[model samples]
Target: MSQLERADRILDTAQDLLLRWGYRRVTIDEIAKRAGVGKGTVYLHWRTRDELFLAVGAREAVAMIEAVAAAMRADPAEIALHAYMRRFFLEAMRRPVLRALFTRDTDTLDRFLSSPARQPLQGAKLLASREYLGALADHGLLREDLRPEDLDYSLPTIAFGFFAIEPLLPKELALGLEEKADQLADVLRRTYGPARPPSPARLAAAAPEVVEIFERLAREYGAVAYGTTKGGDPEHGS
Candidate 1:
């Protein structure tokens, strides 16, 4: 198989192992064996076990970026902060990888995700999401008086709070994921929405650029996770 294909195979195996056995238990040799490659072959794709898992996380990030992009492309209204958050949360909840990253459940991949080296990429992704809010503000789709720093802190706190707390509640008391997301979206809109929403034309124009910014950052994350320079081709990377 080609290098890229092997890399993908390794990543797939790693993710499976990670979900089945938390980060501390999964070993590079096992991933290699599952992928039908020698242990050294895994090192060619990712220099360390942490890097390999980060790459798995990065792949999840890419999926999220694409989901957001697709949502915006499908509905111009999604460029609005509320709609975007609703879609993003629902998508994140649906994907196991993303759910693991967002909620950081101990029974899941929390140990790997909370690593010191992983902090930078996690912080960068948060910053990029904040930038998306800024993009909407720039287009006048958000409140005029909103401060960037406040936004940088607020939205994530709210989203993270929901993810962190929801599972602790009794299932009978807990709302379905979609229902909760819709409520969260409404709350964000009421709190941050512009006095008058932006025109569809404005939203359409802004969405792609914002999505592109996220996509670029996600690629940088993948590069970092795989121990390669940003924008490096998967096929060619060591």
Candidate 2:
């Protein structure tokens, strides 16, 4: 095996350990053993455990963003936006290390979450729905004066709350995942139209590109994760 491949293998092992075991308990010796390398070899790549952990954190972030994109792609027509969020949050919350990171990394999540203006790769995939809604207003498919930003915040805010907070709450108020997702979709229906709704055919046709972009993202995430393993700091001190 190449020297560089060995280094990444070690880092991947260390990262998985950190995520599963948390910072204090995970150790270099374990990482080395998992990587099938000597303790000295692990030291050669990262000077400290902290640096290795940070590298893992960065990897997880990239994987997450990539996963979010991919989920959009895999979603069926009716399930597009909701599927993306459900998958993103579901994938995100399952990882112990990531959940801790997301809870603590509020600023980072805010910078990326739903705000297409700031997040290009993610936003492009999401814009169609927003634009479709706006065009709905413009074309008189919906109310004329309902501002786009309000639409952006209103239903998504409810969806975000239910998706994010509802799971962690007690069973009495839990809403569960499916039920919560249904509620969010209902919020959209109510806000969009209790009476005359846009033709599903029209909205779906107008919004193809966004979902397609995300579909591409979902399909590419694993490959991207593998690629990161390739680009990471090469067998340092070699």
Q: What would the per-residue lDDT of candidate 1 be over residues 2-26, giving only the tens digit for each residue? A: 5667678888899998889888789
In order, the Cα lDDT scores of the candidates are: 0.77, 0.53
> Among all windows of ten consecutive residues in candidate 2, which has the lowest summed lDDT?
110-119
Model 2, span 98-127: residue lDDT tens: 665544434333222233222322454356
The per-residue C-alpha lDDT of model 1 at residue 208 equals 82
Candidate 2: stretches off by over 4 Å: 1-15, 24-33, 37-76, 79-148, 151-157, 163-168, 171-175, 192-200, 215-238
After the best TM-score superposition of candidate 2, give how far the Cα of residue 38 lies from its true spot, in angstroms: 7.2
* Deviation (Å) of 136 in candidate 1: 1.5
* C-alpha TM-scores of all predictions: 0.88, 0.51
Model 1 scores a TM of 0.88
List the lowest-lDDT window of 10 residues for candidate 1.
229-238
